[model samples]
Target: MSGLYRDVGVVLRTYKLRESDRIVVIHTKENGKIRAVAKGVRKTRSKFGARLEPMSHVRLLLYRGRELDIVSQAEAVEPLSPMLSSLDRASQGLAALEAVDQLSLEREPDPRAHAMLVGVLRTIAAKPSPLNVPAFYWKLLAHEGLRPQLDACVRCGDSEPSARLVAFDLVEGGVLCRSCRSGQAISEPALELLRDILGGRLQSALDREESPVTHEVAALATRALEHQIERRLRAVAMFERG
Candidate 1:
């Protein structure tokens, strides 16, 4: 193991250890997800306290070990304090972190996923808008290889004459069209807007001032993500309640 090294990372979660220490989980740009002990972080006067909070983006000096690393020093890159201060933005931020945590494996380098997550965090911190949060989530899922087929039917792979109703198969990782939805659950509006969102046409859908479709898409996307991850995220539940 290396004696010490530096990496830019986003704090995914943190837990108190002992009276004045903390265990932090961070998604780094260089080394991917890592867990490190932030000694004395729980202390009131600890310099690393603010930098160890969830959603905080920081440059950390890590002392690598066989099992876990130690966060020797940390400097804030983007505190994300503003986003964490707002209830809605905070919930969204937590949801994003939880999703990444659920999908990412330890010490695996995924630069695209890391960049997407950092971008999402920056956006949420700068602007507290739920309108684009679902879109971000959808894009992340796509990046993670769980994107559902929105342009055509997943069942028969139809390209011509789009279906009125589309049934998203969370287990199958795509959508089924009207003709293929004989015994499958289908949602027409949700499927349509999902296509739009996946195609990066969310602005067009929102320009029409239609929110129901977005809502449905959000729900479906969440369900699909949960199925892929095989576990329900607590942050998502908190987001829904908020």
Candidate 2:
């Protein structure tokens, strides 16, 4: 296991190491999430510095090290360009990366998670939407089997169609009927938007323009994801502030 291995992954983040090196965290197709050292990457002339930037998708050849892997070679597959140029898209993309980093276990092989991250970056770059980040959050939660219950009240299993679901409880993990109402107030449109995101009407939901309902859904989705992960996503705050 102390030799070279090849993989394609998106660089989730990077930090300074020694004078001319960096430590990068990436979520790979074959190896899941990994931490590796990129030597000489801080210098202006370093060949792979841009390729290893956060959100850049690259194919890598890395030498397995005892504590960390060494980047042997890197070729950019999708450079971080257009996404970084727009503040909104950049923050959303970073939030997605942060969420993946939070959920991914080091060296765990999860191809679906890798694909989801890559797809999200591509989506943010090519077709930006207010719902894109929220949709990603919901889809990721669903994949983790932590999806919020929508068909019936999570508390007391109330399924009366006449009883309107008027609230959402993050801790309880679902919508609540009028009787069980607690936590944030939720509108019918917001609930329908949540269902659309998780129930195969994703395209329509994503295509809808920015509205109060969409904003409500986005806020709910962010809170739900943060609740599950139990950490505030810094990038989310950056975008919201911008």
Query: lDDT tens string, model 2, 1-242?
Result: 64989999999999999899999999999998999999999999998868999999999999988999999899999768988888788888888999899988999999999999999899899888999999999999999889899989888788757778888998888989999988889999999999999999998998999999999999898888889888888987776686
For model 1, give the 10-residue run with minimal summed lDDT. 202-211
- Per-residue CA lDDT of candidate 1, range 74-159, in tens? 99986566876778788878888988898889999898989988887877777655545676678888988767676677678775
Residue 145 CA displacement from its true place in model 2, Å: 1.3
TM values, all candidates = 0.89, 0.96
lDDT of 2 at 112: 98
